[model samples]
Target: MKPTGTLPLRAGLGLKPEHYQNALDAAEKAAGGGLWFEVHPENYMIDGGPRLAWLDAIAERYPLSLHGVGLSLGGPEKPDEAHLARLKKLVDRYNPASVSEHVAWSRLGSTYFADLLPPPPTRQTLQTLGDHIARTQDYLGRQILVENPALYLSLQGDISMVQLYVEAAQMAGAGLLFDLNNIYVCAHNVGGSTQDWLEAVPADQVGEIHLAGYTAQDREGDEVLIDSHGAPISGAVWALYESFITDAGPKPTLIERDENIPPFDELMKEAGQANTIMDSVARDRQYG
Candidate 1:
């Protein structure tokens, strides 16, 4: 369900287990926190634990965005009922400011994969994706933003990935979680213009933006970019982020670092940088 509570038009960081106490302290220090925090939701799906308790404390002090990684919205199968029930409980418990899922599948029957695999962007796939998203929203009684996947290889399809992404969200009356690092990685790893993605995306549909870092690796004696959330935001992705907000206006941006997690202060530094960019855009809009 679409959350009635809203996040600040500033920056947020993905909350990690290591930084729970620090996040609580930070959230308590600032008013409305100016900064918000996101989580995988899957981590807190279990009942009555220290992790869930920590999240409860943080949610009370600051706005939370539940960025789910499961549910496999891009798959042919409908969302798992058990998963939806747990997610809905979280939604009801926290009343998060925003909720989101990905445009990739990670499950086949009872077996789950470690990676989020992208689906072909054909008409049939689009229909399945849209139906799944709609069903998820219906079950939760709120809308969700669907994130685009980081593609390693271009799949054959009738429509473009961008088209499939935007259309699926529109079909479900949902929002977009635009990930700048993913697109940057896609362009470098596969082939596409980041500008084309920017041009194709509707600014109004974008409820949140994600900024992260990618790593370069050797594969088959060639260079490939991996969407590794281990390092600081790259200059290229940061430039793309600035360009996006400058043109599309500001959205709730997130410094999404998951793997090789850094210190809380370092993540906050990235979030502060996002705020600086948003502030610049706001000032330009007022003065320009």
Candidate 2:
């Protein structure tokens, strides 16, 4: 299936309860045409409530994207049909510009973990994930993007994560949601060349980009980077984002801050910075 709709190649923020009114007001004022908002469908998988009501109002004025965190697409079994049905309801109601999910599993035999647990990137796991993605798309009747997860420990996979993601997209007819912060954290923890990994990603397969913050701590005298998304975007992550846009051109980028919630203006400041970098890339491509 062809791409349904493309997100404006600009900056967006994850919708938070604290910023609901701010988002609604910005949308009403038409503050920025490229400014968009993303929400986890898992949060809105309900029949009716204030949250859904607020989402209904915000989505009317801004292009929305659904970034799912609980599908557990890479689990041992196929995606849950009941979960898919609920997700489908939200998709049909919202008609979001894009939909995406992580490349990790959080469910195991009816037990659901709060965290997105990384799956071993082995050939067998790849096949399982690809099949699950294919089934998910078939059920939703829309193409979805698969995001790379943060890696803290090495798994028994001969192939690199970039190759696994690219192959999964090809096998399932999906796109990639490249998260620069995750790449940085994973590289710091796993001991690899981040630049080499970035270069290995298929440019055409990337449909969206994610930028977030991470925390570093010393563990047993070894520094480990955590993909916390609870702070501002770090300078190094911003630099990597610029490098990615320089190579891949501009894709829909999002600033995700899930903790330590800040004022709406602060989030907008980060989004504005992303827009600036993307605008610069566009200018260079146009004139150079």
TM-score of 2: 0.97
TM-score of 1: 0.97
lDDT accuracy of residue 113 in candidate 1: 85
Error of 2 at 188 (Å): 0.2
**Model 2 scores what on Cα lDDT?**
0.89
Report lDDT (CA) for all predictions.
0.89, 0.89
Q: What lDDT, from 0 to 1, does candidate 1 have?
A: 0.89
lDDT of 2 by residue, 35-100 (tens): 889999999998998999999998888889999998898789889889999999999999999999
Residue pairs with backbone overlap in model 2? none
